[model samples]
Target chain A: MLGRGEIAIVGAAETTQLGAIPGMSQIMLHADAALNAMADAGLKPSDIDGVACVGPMMPQQIAHYLGITPKWVDGTGVGGCSFMLHVRHAAAAIHAGYANTILITHGESGKSRINATPRPPEPESLNGQFEAPFGPFGPPTLFPIPVLRYMKTHGVTHEDLATVAVVQREWAGKNPRAMFRDPITVDDVLNSRMIAYPFRILQCCLVTDGGGALILTKSDRAKDFPTRPVYILGTGESVETNMVSQMADFTSSRAFRVAGPTAIEAAGIDRKDVDHLMIYDAFAHLPLYGLEDLGFCKPGEAAGFIREGNTRPGGKLPLNTNGGGLSYTHTGMYGMFALQESVRQMRGTAPAQVPGAKISVCHGVGGMFSASGTIVFSNERP
Target chain B: MLAPGRAKPKPTPETKHFWDGCKQGKLLLQRCGDTGKAYFPPRPFSPYTGTRNVSVFEASGRATLHSYVIHHRPVPGFTPPYAIAVVELEEGPRMMTNIVECEQTPEALQLDMRLEIAFTPMDEEITLPLFRPAKGGR
Candidate 1:
């Protein structure tokens, strides 16, 4: 849990534009985000001693461009949740006296430039050869399979999945940082061109080119910073089977099942006490599975939960207030945005701030539900 | 002219048997000798006990359609308006397959619909396993 020792987010920063920008390289975007984040925390580049990054366009290149040598560097390539996992690692590193302050950074130009079109390494063994031959290619096709299965088992409809996009778009309309701010309807989603079975164009996330960064430090050190501090109360991470074929349940994510309880317990608070939620929304169905695995809803009930408008604004649970990856800019690194949103909410700086939000939860799912990371945040001390 | 290195389906040794079995109209699953658990996408080691020496067995042709989705768009190699389903075999393993020979609509896809295995050969090297409504349809 996060409360055992003091780890607070003293600063957070993001690039001005999230969509396509042809002028900037990946490293430049990351450097710009890091500078903005450092300014937000009222700190200097020299203050950073540790670095953690997700699957950026070029990690070492970014480090070189920043010119801040970190004593500890973690480049965990588990996809979006990698940033949340980095936060957990940063907290431990700060606690262990390995690094006093850590900067977690991510940047991508996936839309603008196709960097390093290196050939994929040949599968080392026989089993890898079998599955790779099918041309699913990206996450869009891979993730929908389980969601389809979930729909079949629970009698969930495309309309049910469309509701997620519609609600998130509503939030995006309020968020200036979101890529798509226009309001959308269920009919719009249903009528959109189909990419995979049951998943319309609206159900997929955007391929944005953007950057984001977060600064983490010891709790006591955070008090000395210029801004209000948001503490990290608890954190959990788990990995399921890598291959989609080997997953135990297609509809339910094992990472959430394993990490959710550990995170809440570590925070030392009842699940109901958490005031805000930030579940990853790479695909619209992700948050549904996350909520069910985190015990917010029972299995096979998340569809009904969304249909009743519980996750929309003014509803009991206001999810993805920053528009999430669905309507917001995914940048292929949504976990960073989730962490940044929670930190802002806890600091009372969110555009759609929850009234007296003292506790919050942020979750990230990486690599075809192969990995899950959960973190609990609170204003209260243990 | 095209380059020599391009996208092509290649089978690994572990999955080769399963593909071969599909061509032969047999659904093969691995069963752990120690735990007596049936597993899909056969693995050399057991997921339950992490024990080695897992044995392969021919699964009963019978299965129950656990869940499915009606894909309106055509996939890379698949045709338009196909039903992708996850069927739970009688041996207690679930596999991804397509449902055919039925109306591709939600109302027709009832949970726990009894289904039997059907195979569609894509090319000389690959054969995909699909399912269709059993004789006495549910």
Candidate 2:
């Protein structure tokens, strides 16, 4: 458990601009995020002894770009959730006295890049033989199939899924870093151009080219730093299957069901103690399914919960305070944003801060809900 | 030249029986001879008991519509405006298949709706097992 260690988030930073930045390479974006995060923690580049990254990005590439060599390096590619999982790894590494300060980073340029040639998957890559043959090539299409299944099982309408987009857009209106700040109505969501059925343009997240980074160190060490430290209370990770087609339940994610309990147990807290939530919302329906699988709501009741405004601002539980991937920026790796939002909430720095947020839960699902990572954060460490 | 429909999925020696059953409009699942536990994406060996003597058995195509969504996007082979559903078979296996011969609307899809297998021939070597609302389109 991360709580057994002394790790805490001392700094966080995200690229100021999301969406199309024509000139910058992915490495530049990563370096920019790293520099800003170090500056936010009031630490120099030499202070970081560890580096971790998620997805297809390379850790050595980022290290070279930053002009620093980390003693410990990990390039865990567990899809979008890899960064949250890295927090746990960092905690263990720090407790083992391997590294005192660690930097977890992510960067991607999904949009504004046209491939003259399609990059082939590695011969041994899990996706190479299993999924590429099927038509669910991208994350957007892969998730919609399950979203449709959820809608059918729960009697959730397209408008119900749109409600998620509408609420996030409302939250984005307050966030200057959000990619789309304009207010949108549920009708607008329904009327938006359809990418996949039941999923309109609004329901899908934007393909913004950006980066985010976080700095983690011992809680005692963070006291010397300028910013308040958000202690990592617990962390859990689980994977059901590598391929989407092999999963037993398409609508219900096994990863969340398995990882959520472990996280809550590791945190030594009950579900009622969580004050805010930062669930990965690669698509609007993901968080809804996540909430159900995490036991926040009963099966087939997430749509009703969202319809009653339980997840909006001033609701019982405010979610995605940074506006989430739907309205914010989804750099393919959405776990970075979830952790960033949780840290902001714990430190009382969120644009839409929940009052007296003592404990917060951040969750991320990687690769079509096949893998899940959950972490619980607290303002005070035991 | 490429054909206009779903390409035939080549079944290896392990999966040939499963695809053959689908062509016959029979849902076939592999059950371990030792444990009698059914599994899907048919394997030559049983995962439960690690038994090599896995037996292929005809499964009751009757199932409940566990969940579904209507997709407007067209894939390489599937047409636009198709409904993909996750059906929980009577034998406790779940699989993804398309729903046909029913209006693709939320009101039309009810949870736990009873469905029966409907096979559609895609090409010479491929036959997909789809589902439609049972009897009265329920």
Candidate 3:
């Protein structure tokens, strides 16, 4: 229960150029986002005392390159959801007086794939021994294992899958920063080249090079910052299983069920209290799972729920208002962008602003349901 | 020679026997004597009882299709539009594998269809256990 109004995100910013920038290295994206966030906060490197980041590099290296010595740092790398966990941990640290002005950063060249190094899992390890030999290449290939099963069990059709992609592009059309802004239809998705079964090019997220950073400090000290503080209402993090096959249920992520409710409960609010929502849409099926597992809809009902247009811009929920990873900048780890949207919606500065939106629940997944982190943000303080 | 990027499972302390069973043209699963919980993807100890005492037992090598995808993307050692699938073994655990010896299409690849194991030799030391439609399945 971390939402006692103890810590807040004072500043947040994404890299200036999100699409293909061949000149920028992975570390450069990180540094760029860090500088942009500091500039957004009207603070210098000297004002930061803590750091958190995820990539091939170390936090100390980022701190050194930024010319700041962090009194506290965290490299909680569980894929994309790593930054959400960092924000939670930083909040706890800020409350405990471990450090002040904590900075969390994320940068990845998911398309460029520059400077990304994943240590090969031990052949004896769980995935290496059993799962890897099957040749599920990447997220595009592997993630479908459970999603396909989910579609079958839920009786979700290809039309339903395409509808998810179609509606997301509607949101992307409003975002000048979104990469693919051409208005697309459900048939456009159903007819696209199949990267994996049931996943066309449109149903998947974009591969771009991007970075983002957020600054957290004590809530009492937040008024001094140039930007309005987006108060942290609650945060929750959990892991389901390392392998997709081992997940307790293919239709829903146990991790999401655990983390999502935990955050809403910690904030002491009901699901309806969430005025704006940002569920990590690494693929179309994710939001469906997030909606069901987060208890917005019952199991197997999210497909029809989205079909009825409840999550569209004018709809009740306004999910993935940033166009989502499906159309927005998804540099492999998409949680950072999702978190940024929640911050923007709370600040009333979103490109597609939800009118009078106060509370936002942003959920993210790490691997193929390998891990999850939920964050609840509010414009109001407790 | 196999394709350039096939990930050959390097057997470890807990998994050596499972690979060994595949090499010997048999399917293996680990069972705990303490809690009677059967598990796949061998481990050093039983997940149910947490006991170090476990033994390998032969499986029927028969399974039913739990789920599948006709992966249109290219994978290492595989051509596009190949079927990658998960099968629920008779022993009651699912394994990720490739379905072979049949056309990779929705008409041919049905869920919950009965299937049997077929081993492909990746190398002299490693053999992959692939599945194909059982005689009665279309």
* Model 3, position B131: C-alpha lDDT score: 90
Off by over 4 Å in 3: A1-3, A118-124, B1-5
lDDT of 3 at A99: 93
Docking class of 2: acceptable
Best candidate (score: TM-score): 3
lDDT of 2 at A303: 80
**Root mean square deviation (Cα) for candidate 2:** 3.6
Best prediction by DockQ: 3
In the range A169-242, model 2's lDDT, one tens digit per residue, is: 88888888888989999999999997766688899988878888999998888788888888988888988876
What is the per-residue lDDT of model 1 for residues A1-382, given as tens digits with 9 covering 90 to 100? 2345389888898876778877777777777789989999888878888888865444565567787778888887787898888888899988888888898887777688636123242653322343343334467766776776687677888799999999999888888878899999999999988876568889988888888899999898877888888888888999986656457887798888988877888888887787899999988898889889999999889889988998888888888889998888887768888888888888888887877888889999897788989989876656
Each model's TM-score, in the order given? 0.88, 0.86, 0.97
lDDT of 1 by residue, B69-123 (tens): 5556544655556565667888987766667788867678776889998776666
DockQ of 1: 0.32
Quote the lDDT for B44 in model 2.
Answer: 84
lDDT of 2 by residue, B1-138 (tens): 123544346666777776688778787888989988888767788877888998889988887887555667767776666565667788887776766777777677776888888877666665666777788655
